[model samples]
Target chain A: MTITDELLRNNEQYAAQFSGPLPLPPSRHLAVLACMDARIDVYRALGLNEGESHVIRNAGGVVTEDGIRSLAISQRLLGTEEIILIHHTDCGMLTFTDDGFKQSIQDEVGIRPPWAAESFPDPFDDVTQSINRIMASPFIPQKGSVRGFVFDVATGKLIEVTV
Target chain B: MTITDELLRNNEQYAAQFSGPLPLPPSRHLAVLACMDARIDVYRALGLNEGESHVIRNAGGVVTEDGIRSLAISQRLLGTEEIILIHHTDCGMLTFTDDGFKQSIQDEVGIRPPWAAESFPDPFDDVTQSINRIMASPFIPQKGSVRGFVFDVATGKLIEVTV
Candidate 1:
């Protein structure tokens, strides 16, 4: 997809403001797992500058197999010792049932999408649970810390749910 | 990092337009790994409407170990078959040496961050090299497709560098 002229201009301006490589502050080198929903501006939500944290986003901000693997690598190799999983209210992942979603696409397209596994996974309700699962998984670095939160889309407020 | 009132109003308008799950036409579920630069608008860059694709962002958009892991799950479990890796020009990841970064942060925060690895990794001149590394990584699903591009912050243009 091509970027809109307005967005292109905004990025140009943003790039112009920073002169050097950002200093990765000692207490702020975090890794965040957040929803892909357009409403969530992770940088603003976390009070972060461009390079302070690494933000990973997916449909529900849920930690799936790949999420776990990435978390493992982030802790073990990418210099991320803390993880914040940010799920949010009014999340699309919570709105549709798995079968309903698959059928909706199937009706529009002839083939079923491959990732339509055995079930539709709701990321909002499952993020905290997913965090626990990830922290317990063998892949995560033993010393790394993982926390979870729910961002209020309506108010743009972040409330820590678990640590 | 609070979202501006203008953004919130725009988001509300955008949300009002979609009342239900939008259909994902064939090959519509694009998976993109982009940098977490606030300048980059993943939706606008891709001309994406609500619920069109899954965007996974991180520092530099470099397909680090975690990026691949997330890609694997996105393809294998989240209905994403195509991958797009977007790295931009004038990236913060390029500016500082590891030592400079660490020292800058320590001087400001007093404590060293736990994830402080040896140094900051640069993927600037090695755009093609970085893409190849991801395309070759085992963490990505074997059956899925992968592509990479470099977004020029100066021009607001995305140049397809590899496939």
Candidate 2:
């Protein structure tokens, strides 16, 4: 069976006890952009529940044009005010570079993508850079509450990164 | 005091109970692409824990160019074989159009972005489209295990979409 079948069976149980219809805007007026790493549990690590905060994640949680577009809507249409960027230790993103990865894919598939890998050497520095990216975004409003953190995957702890 | 301060204070308590070193790759070998809706508790809703599934989320989880890049790396390098696309009802993406949103931003900021909002009217159809996008991506291998679902924000249930 596909994972879809398994998850559907699981959702049957979840729906049996479903309790929802939460508000549209997050209660905390906050949004988190974090890595897609499996080891970092954004909600549990940050003590968030449903309807509390918006968790926007992607590889490395790097601020991209698409991310900025999302954040723009999150602030303009929704009511999110604070932006938090979280990258994690032992992230797969730290394993490769843009040129190196593209070259590898080119060698394998005979096609080079016109996109970026957005890899970084250190999670700490990446977080700082992401924080600055969001802060510097013309789309995001005047919220000086932008910050970044390095989530320790081994320990489930978040370490703040100053920019 | 910013939200950063509050989160940092919370992280201090969480780190006190730190346990070190989970493996580098996800244990479940699954990757989930979903919306950044505040009401969807991805981990709880899907019964996922840290170190299980790689969750890639953005505004609508619509499988952008960047998302494809991330998924390619996830499968090629991280050993993730299955992918699940989850979009939810009452999503903010349903509430706007690219042209309209771009015009609004241009009015407000005097600079129009070169990005698309990637808005969709129906979450179910959008999920299917995303699944097709991933499956059609040349970078993604012939996994044939990709699936999509529409999560009920009001019911905490995920309904599978047959594509």
i-RMS for every candidate? 8.5, 1.4
- The DockQ-derived docking category for candidate 2 is medium
A17 Cα displacement, candidate 1 (Å) = 2.3
Clashing pairs in 1: A44-B1, A70-B66
Q: Evaluated on chain B only, what are the TM-scores of all the candidate structures, in order?
A: 0.75, 0.96
lDDT of 1 by residue, B1-163 (tens): 2222332344445445435433432135557788755455565555554455667776567565445545644554456666667877766566555566545546654644344222235444445655687667544544345656677655556666643
Q: Please give each candidate's TM-score.
A: 0.56, 0.96
Deviating ranges (above 4 Å) for candidate 2? none
- lDDT per residue (tens digit) for residues A1-163 in model 1: 3323333454455545535443333235456778765556565455455445666676667676546544544554446667778887766565456666555545654545455322224444476677778766655554345667776655555555643
Error of 2 at B26 (Å): 1.2
In terms of TM-score, how similar is model 2 to the real structure? 0.96
- Could you report the DockQ of all the candidates, in the order they appear? 0.11, 0.72
In order, what is each prediction's RMSD in angstroms?
Answer: 9.1, 1.4
